[model samples]
Target: MSGTGRQLAVTADEVVDAELVDEGAALSPAPADPGATPAVHTDRDRHLSPETVAAIEESVADSTRRAYSADREAFAAWCATEGRVPVPASGETMAEWVGYLTVTPRKRTGKPAGPSTIERAMSAVTSWHEEQGHPKPNMRGARKVLNAYKDRLAEAKAEAARARQATAALPSQIRAMLIGTDRSTLAGMRNAALVLLGFATAARVSELVALDLAAVEETEHGYDVTLYRKKVRKHTTNAILYGTDPATCPVRALRAYLAALEAAGRTEGPLFVRVDRWDRIAPPLTRRNKDTGIVEPIGDPAGRMTAEAAAEVVERLAVAAGLSGDWSGHSLRRGFATAARAAGHDPLEIARAGGWVDGSRVLARYMDDVDRVKNSPLVGIGL
Candidate 1:
């Protein structure tokens, strides 16, 4: 499928004026035979591929995909077992499947299927239907059912949330860890920069990972970085909607990080590159033969710095500070909100700082959870 077309010509000045041309062509493999029709080819089949369906599922967080994938496979298997065509099912079949699922316990969660779970399963199937030229299921009715189920889920989640202890690094812990690190080493400097940037910017893991060297900008207002969050959509011409905040966007730590990167003469490409345990440029490693295998040198690492990696960085820093609990990248973001609230920063200011479209929404969802400082009387203060 890849080739270059070239023409060769020979020229002479005073000799017999003549032209000779030779053309080069690449190997062309034979077209694939259209075998017996596939199990799920509809008029809209051209709009989607098996891989597209897989990618859509994968575009969610990694762990969520695990459950969704299982559900998808189970539904597919049930259809196969019943000798039903694997094409898009009708609304009646879907309703029947939902009914069956309500009674059937989930293989992994080992609980009677809840409405929210069923809704997600239906969404997956619904997406499949649209991809295969069938009409989309009525989401409004599905949402009503989902909302009714969500009430039950909300009660369960409340109990769960109560048990889920708040997880975030204390200011003392973060400060101690940052000061304790030997900033002389590249890794140490990078770690310090990461901690500062991670906490100050309150960025998502994907946003931090997407940063390029050029994205970090220094202006009179302080310093700021441009990050394309995963969930945002691009415009018609594929231009990013660059949301800028003032230098208060943790420009200091980011500037320091950039300085170090510049001193090392790395001024382009991904701002965060991999360094292995041995301090070598971490080569691309793939999960092969039940073991990690390094591939020949490639442009980038084997994969993006996943959320797990971002979480691990926080965990390591937490351990350094002798802290515990589910401290991860998310905690860092939450920490920013908590700390900002504790610092008497305006909720609207914090929202704008975090690059949210609406400050009110962030105030309602994130900042509202900030608890008042405990034991203010324990510390000595001037009367």
Candidate 2:
């Protein structure tokens, strides 16, 4: 954090929560000029109540905040080297940055930015300027640069769609990932429960993170989940019976996770809370100790997992299990629909199962691919 070009591979998950959640992470100037003022007005607006402050910080998702923070750092670094005004970046400055991203591979992975990543970075730049009470920098030039970069990505066209649509992972693939984890650890237990529950219910990232302790009920057969809210128009409850496999059973996995939380004196609250690298539940949020002049993880726990964090669970697990693809958050929902259609479930039944509007074109799209392959007339003839 101190250097302009220090170690650069650190991911957002590794950074402290304060920078990711609260708008405290500053867009600092060059490391050579440590005396330069910070972009965040640390002393301003001190009269806001504790609850009000918390609400404002919580207004944005933690994942988005972390992304924005990283964007700020990247812009600051570029500006520091180029001697441009970092805060009130001109439209020309923004356009140049987009052009830079178009050619420059990421420092960690050495992969070029896709259209979506470039667009998000643009949003981050504008957002930081707005947060600092500056007028919105015109991004028309930036948009032009982005469009040109996208046109040059004909070879990457398939890869570009990945940000918008994730490849589905069937039940077998999900089961393999669930079974591959070391459930003895707290993180492992929570992750298994999350992935399985998501696959079983076909829950979207938003719905999965919104669940409270009271929302899930354990019954003799399985678990009954009451989804009081849904992303789609339908608002209804859902229930699931026990899994056939003990090693990857959604009900059993959830039970183990609940038991682990109970042992930690957490009886009722957020169903899924933050877990740190130390395998500890709800690690104290991070802050710099006033006296020590060093940053430290401190303060109250950030209880529930953000939707972005919830979505990452599957991808992390997939990579650990050596599986690869455009698999991610939406994969769980898509996978459920795919699996159900393969099982000969009716389109209406599948639609209701995942909270999609009945007779929806979206649902049909999910079903069509399998139907074409499974019901092909050449299948029995053994092509």
Model 1 agreement with the true structure over 224-279: per-residue lDDT tens digits: 56666443332111111122332222455566667876776678877766656765
* Backbone clashes counted, model 1: 1
Off by over 4 Å in 2: 1-164, 286-302, 358-361, 380-383
Per-model clash counts, in order, read 1, 0
| TM value for model 2 | 0.58
lDDT of 2 by residue, 1-383 (tens): 22222112233333447665544325543254578766664544435455554554454556665786687788889989888897799999888888998888887768778788877777777766655557778899999988877776755564554445677878778877776789998888999888888888888887887788888888877888876433353555677768788876888999999999999887887788888878888655777778997887543254788787988888988887788777788899899998899889888877777888646776788898799999888889956
TM-score of each: 0.58, 0.58
RMSD of 1: 15.5
CA-lDDT, candidates in order: 0.57, 0.76
lDDT of 2: 0.76
